[model samples]
Target: MKSIVPCLWFSDDNCEAAVNYYVSIFPNSSIESMSYYPDEALDEHFIGKTNKVITAEFILNGQRLMALDGGPVFRFHEAVSFTIECEDQAEIDYYWEKLSHVPAAEQCGWVKDQFGLSWQIVPYNMGSLIQSDAQIQAMMAMKKIIITELENA
Candidate 1:
């Protein structure tokens, strides 16, 4: 495992959804495990009901991401987004298409999944370029470059 990994909680079939999504995007990615609740249970109330997924894991661009069917108490939002520092526009474009499956989510360089996970797709050195700028015109130029790239797609 890496020093840190992202764990996402979802409701119902969210585990499956996440697996399908990330694996499809990352070239060498694949689902590791998927376990469903058993039909018979220990308790009277638990009988024939789905309780939990034993484990669910997948790899995205060689990064490990985990998911669980832990219900809707927790959710994904823009407040916590995963940023992809892509090498070039092609890399950004590839992620943009794979991650932004939701048609209405293409906005402000951010996109949301059906499960509401927010992701920021950007070029690798874009952030440093913006931070290094001391002049307003320089920042504007950088912004224009990103917008132009996005538009050209």
Candidate 2:
């Protein structure tokens, strides 16, 4: 059992779809388990959402996460985001291409996926690179980070 895990609340009824999408994107990932709202509870509270996913436990890139179909009481925000540390430009490009769905939200290597989850596709050495004077300016100029440009900067 994981000591701590991130729980994502989904307003939509597509929690399974979202889990599958994330499992497909990351390596060593799989759906660990799933549970649905009881019929009595569903009838009493969920209304039309019968048999809907109440919670789903999954692993993404070896990290355990839980997804909850919690209705529209809450929403995802940029304040909470997952960072994908890429080994090189290829990995960065791959994650960016697969995860980025909202163009307007793309900025400084950060992107918002179709499910409104924000992700940062960054090179593993981004910390050191950002420490350089010119690299900071170069990063600010583009949405997706270019490793070569950072190296040059």
| Alpha-carbon lDDT of model 1 | 0.65
The TM-score of predicted model 2 comes to 0.94
Residue 127 of candidate 1: its Cα lDDT? 54
State in Å the error of residue 131, model 1.
4.6
Clashes of 2: 0
Candidate No. with top lDDT: 2
lDDT of each: 0.65, 0.91
TM-score of each: 0.71, 0.94
Q: Kindly give the number of clashing pairs for every candidate.
A: 0, 0
RMSD after Cα superposition, model 1 = 4.7
lDDT of 2: 0.91
Question: What is the Å distance of residue 151 in model 2 from its true position?
Answer: 0.7
lDDT digits (tens) for residues 15-94 of candidate 2: 87899899998999999999987776535686767677889999999999999999888989999999999999999999
Error of 1 at 48 (Å): 7.4
